[model samples]
Target: MQAQSLSYYEILHLPPPPHTTPTISEIRKAYHSALLEHHPDKSILTANDSSTPTVDEIVEAYNILSTSSLKVLYDQQLESVQQSKKIEEARFKRLIAQADSIDLDDFQTATSCVQHSKDIFAESSSITLSTGYARESCHGYPEDTCNLQQIWFRNCRCGKDDAYLVTESMLEHAFLESDNAQSDDRQILVQCSRCSTWIRVLFSLAE
Candidate 1:
């Protein structure tokens, strides 16, 4: 499925000419001549079939060297090959210096630090928060009638009588609280202690 690299001379199976670059016309001529000589369709009736290459092979070779982008890439590859010895020499020197300084103790220290970080992360891998509310009334001046008056907070924290009455503004505040705290890996539930109403807050630790 992937195209293979080929040099211009290799594609045409020709010897490289001395101090010369072939023109586009010369390249085209060489391609057609090679194809006519070796293409499977042309060689099917020839007695020397063993010497001929396949049509696909000839087409693939021509397709690469004939295109400007592909030819440029091939030339660049050739340049890289010519420079590879120098590159490898530099790399070998750097590696020797690194090898001289690297030690097993340093590797162990890095591994331990990574494991410690992972352990700290595992402590609060996930958290859940939820909230709900309930209403209650006490006997007062309007004793005969039941009122919808209610106290609200995050989760039930009874006996303190510190729960605030729910209002439009207070409800908005509670929603914001949950939204702001959702990103932490800590569970915080708030509710009216006396009314047994509550809200859950979920948060997670940063990665």
Candidate 2:
């Protein structure tokens, strides 16, 4: 039988022991009861040519759990499965939390929604890139359109004037929609050649 079909504990309708294994007496009791209840010859349904989890099937589960080495292996497999499930759940929750107040079920606006999972470690503490970096493409504008060069800086904020906006010199991934996406939106700076608007996408969480 497939390992997934029934956890040894589930076959006997028993809970996992506190220490990750059942006692020998407990295993014996459950196995005996299960065999008595589901014995093919004695069970009415099976006597009438019906099929169900035979007593042997129960025994198969019992043997695995009752044996010391097999139980250890089964416990490891179970732990791995449980761990994987937890990680997946955590990842989904993280994605949902970053959804920019947008509904995850909304597949229509999913493409437009930009969710930022702010990592303090990833954030730059200070401006490392030198100012006046030229950019050919703005995030919102078409490709090769943002011709504004010479990104300047201020006290705490950056530039967003009519002609050109000074990038923070640390603003990375101003256009990336998702962290799992194909392209890396982490770049120095971007500005629109038409509107002279600088593309700085800082999520509320990152702020």
Candidate 3:
């Protein structure tokens, strides 16, 4: 994923806003852990796992997050991006509804007009679980027997209850890349069915 598209908190594996800001100690711990896990040598050892983030990217994320002044600026930008997304989502839905009666050419034109808005929010926006961070077990089955996989719900800012549905496989995918389950928690992005807003589910995998 592009570094600009993700928050510094995510790069460091710490919870982002709408949740408590991590302490310096927590940030330091996460930075060291990320360095160990996503090290260039580690990537080489793993046969050049293309999915691994570059060391420079990790260091950049650390630099911004570790500095209080930069962190504030970063947080403001995140908020601005989120606000723009919500506005775009609302506008797009209205346009879609209105476009139903328009000709195909007109519909295409209308959509293209909002391309900039779409680009701004194209990446999955991250957020914590409404139920708070909870421990989950995998039940020895790859993804099938994770009993707690029952659809978890989160309310959306759109005033819809249970609009964000957390599914079984979503949990599995987050931890799939990990060589160690107990090392740290992982995040999976989900969207609000009603608002089309993306959410990052931060969760832990318990053996």
Each model's C-alpha lDDT?
Answer: 0.45, 0.48, 0.59
| Candidate 1 ranges beyond 4 A from true positions | 1-6, 14-18, 44-53, 82-207
lDDT of 1 by residue, 102-148 (tens): 21122111111211222332443431111111111121224343323
Q: Between the candidate structures 2 and 3, which one is better when assessed by TM-score?
A: 3
Worst 10 residues of 1 by lDDT: 103-112
- Comparing candidate 1 with candidate 3, which one achieves the higher TM-score? 3
Per-candidate TM vs. native? Answer: 0.31, 0.41, 0.45
Best to worst by lDDT, what's the order?
3, 2, 1
Considering every candidate listed, which one attains the maximal TM-score? 3
Q: Per-residue alpha-carbon lDDT of model 3 for 1-207, expressed as tens digits?
A: 435466677778889886888888999899999888878766456336555456777788888888999999988988898899999899866654432121112111111111122222233234233322122211123434223333456566788654555555556766887677666666656666776566555666651
